[model samples]
Target: MPGPVFLRGDTVSMRTLERDDLDLLQKYRNHPEVRRLLGRVHPQNRDKVEQDFEGYMSNAVNLLACVEEDPVGFVALFDWNESSGHAELAYWVAPEHQGNGYASEAGELAVEYAFDERRCHRLDAGAHATNAASRALLEKLGFEEEGRRREHVFLDGEYVDTVLYGLLAHEWRD
Candidate 1:
């Protein structure tokens, strides 16, 4: 509900993103396959990362999925406004951790925070249509597809539709 902190679930635990996580975050950053799946942006260097962390300080809603003290992935809630009582969710599981159910588990806890703890009325997110894995994860978490924006993102040299999905506070199940 406030700043990110350690969140424990059955199979994994999520901790707040920290500057000390640079090495682990960089591991994902430098992995070619991981970068490709994350949309192949220009590689991030140390200076850029330093600035990125500085930016996160103001935005400030983020979580890191961990297991046995090892960094596995990240999940974040943002776009917060007290009056609106809603926030957008986003997450990424490292390539090595992709098939382990980490995102879904961590995502559930984040949703709980937004709806139960933070008293948020709605939670929403979008994924590229081609990202079947992400789409399936959202659906499994009870999010419904609301709409799609055709050719909204330029990915891999071609336009891809962005699929919007959402779940209301009343729609959530434990």
Candidate 2:
């Protein structure tokens, strides 16, 4: 069974990722379509997935994005700096679940949790320059395009640019 829901939105809910869900997580991590945009170039095994899961549990507010108990995606606020009141956000929806507005709604919930519950001052995110959908999602969430890193990540056989985005707590409308 999946862990209890930690945050809930109108159509999506964010839940603590559990050990029981590691297999699904592994599937997502290895899926070529999902991994490409996620900047994951190498295939991941179950052992590696479990190891990463441990790290996520210790280091981040990593959650599974779900809709009515069906897991659809993943979202996280990681690399948190309590003293600096800042963190980074990352999220991805399964290909089958993409375009259903789950990513957007889950992202809103994560942003709210970061600023209100976690009391973060700013949140940062990045997307591959070629990923229009991810870029659009960040913009839709009130994040500003801060800058771009030229040829920052190697994906699908060549280097690609990364577009950085940031959102300040005071700047967040909700």
Candidate 3:
């Protein structure tokens, strides 16, 4: 079963990620279609996935996006710096759950938590240049495209640019 609700939205609810959801995490993390876009060129074995989960549990505000008890996606505010009040946002939806607005809703909830609940001064996100959907989603959440790193990451056998985005607490409309 999923953890208790941490943030609720119209059609999606964000819950704390749990060890029980490791299978769900692995399902999407290893899915070829999902991995490519996420820039994960290699498939993660169960042990690696477990390690990543542990890191998330220890270091990030990781949440599982669910619909009526079924996990559809994941979201997180990681790399937090309390003194600077800064953090990075990252999220991904299952391939079967893509285009249902779950990610967008979850992202809004995350941003709200960052600025209001966490008292964050700024938030940052990065997406591969080829990931138009991700870029669009970040912009839709009021994140401004601050810069692009030329050929920053090698993915799918070629180097890809990384688009950096930022949103300040004062600049947030909500």
What overall lDDT goes with each candidate model?
Answer: 0.80, 0.93, 0.91
For candidate 1, the per-residue lDDT at 131 reads 91
Model 3 residue 88 CA deviation in Å: 0.2
Clash pairs for candidate 3: none
Q: Against the correct fold, how does model 2 do in TM-score? A: 0.96
lDDT at position 111, candidate 1: 90
Show where candidate 2 strays beyond 4 Å: none
Model 1 lDDT-worst window of ten: 1-10
Best by lDDT: 2
> Model 1 over residues 75-116: C-alpha lDDT tens digits?
778888669888888888888788988889989989988898
Score candidate 1 by lDDT.
0.80
- Rank the candidate models, highest lDDT first: 2, 3, 1
- In model 2, how large is the Cα lDDT of residue 2? 68
Candidate 2 per-residue lDDT, tens place, 1-174, comes to 569999989999899988899999889999989999998888899999899988755699889999989999999889999999999999999999999999999999999999999899999999999999999999999999999999999987789999999999999956
Candidate 3 scores a C-alpha RMSD against the true structure in Å of 1.2
Per-residue accuracy of model 3 over 8-124 as CA lDDT, tens digit each: 999999999888888888878888988888888778888888999876557999899999989998898999999999999999998888998999999999999999999999999
Q: Which is better, 1 or 2, measured by TM-score? A: 2
